[model samples]
Target chain A: MEKTYKVEGMTCGGCVQSVEKAINAVAPAATVKVDLENNHVTVTGIEDDNLVAQAVENAGFDYEGPVF
Target chain B: MEKTYKVEGMTCGGCVQSVEKAINAVAPAATVKVDLENNHVTVTGIEDDNLVAQAVENAGFDYEGPVF
Candidate 1:
């Protein structure tokens, strides 16, 4: 399944890269993409909400769960 | 200055505590309060937007700048 989250605390390209790396580390098969300008992150993989949430938290950004 | 940010990706009290600690570590005099239910973080201290943003980023939560 795929999910898109509204993220906060990201200011630059580095932040986006960090978040993506964190998510992939936890779910290697997941596809993650972050839009820094829009503050959105989309992920596709097995549904593991906790792992996803932790990845965002670990990267130092706040992540609200799937908005839609 | 005091600012309130809307944070995302926080799932539990532990997330809240982790965020608070990270902020304090960077700015010792800053006061940070996280509302897990509301997903809000209020900070009071000298205004340093970058530091605040970095602190939130370091904690692994997405933080949007002062909502109000």
Candidate 2:
């Protein structure tokens, strides 16, 4: 399953890296892509919304979705 | 002045902190609030959309707005 989340509070490249690292840590095989200009996060593999949400929350940013 | 940005790529609380830090570093006086469940970021004391965008981008996440 692929999921895309709308996120908030990011402010730079480091924030992107942090979000990626945090997600990868929890969802090892999850493929994550971010479009800072547009504020979108697309993830592939594993459909646990809670896990995905926790990953973003744990990383310190607000996230909303499964927007699909 | 206040601004809200939709962000992407966060997966944990740490990501939130990182994003906040990144924004503060650049804007200093800017106040930021993130609502993960809603995917919203509220920022105050700044009116520069570019700077806000840059802050989020630098923090390593994707962002969109000034959404009012």
Candidate 3:
């Protein structure tokens, strides 16, 4: 499964890498990609929304949950 | 003067950019650089601590004031 989230406060490549690392830690098999220009992060191979959210927060960014 | 802040929630380049922009908006002359590996942001040319904090929060990240 795949999901997209609108993360606020991402402004550079470092944020892109941070979000990916954080999510990957929570969902090891998940492939994470961040569209910094859009402030959205897409994760594949993960279905647990709560876990993803937690990881996002833990990583120091605001995760507004999957974008509809 | 220069100040180093320990900001929480920065995870990638986007974060670095966001923080920089946020701070710059408040202190246009401020030179902001974020070290993702250390989760720290160094700002030069600005001296208002409260303003910096507000900018960080407004940027969606926790700004724990200049690192002692």
On lDDT, the stronger of 1 and 2 is: 1
| lDDT (Cα, tens digit) per residue for candidate 2, span B11-35 | 6565667777667777789898877
Give candidate 1 misplaced runs (Cα > 4 Å): B1-68
RMSD values for the candidates in order, in angstroms, are 10.8, 11.7, 8.6
| Candidate 2 wrongly placed segments (more than 4 Å) | B1-16, B19-68
- Quantify all predictions' global Cα lDDT against the true fold: 0.75, 0.74, 0.78
Backbone collision tally, model 1: 16
lDDT for each residue of candidate 3 in A10-42, tens digit (9 for 90 to 100): 676656666777677667799988898888999
Q: Is candidate 2 or candidate 3 better by DockQ?
A: 3
Q: Give the winner by lDDT: 1 or 3.
A: 3
- Give all TM-scores, in the order shown: 0.50, 0.51, 0.53
**TM-scores of chain B alone in all candidate structures, in the order given:** 0.89, 0.88, 0.94
Tell how far residue B4 is off in model 3, in angstroms. 11
Task: Return the TM-score for chain B, candidate 2.
Answer: 0.88
TM-score: model 3, chain A = 0.94
lDDT (Cα, 0-100) at B55 in candidate 2: 68
Fnat for candidate 2 (0 to 1): 0.25
Candidates sorted on lDDT, descending: 3, 1, 2
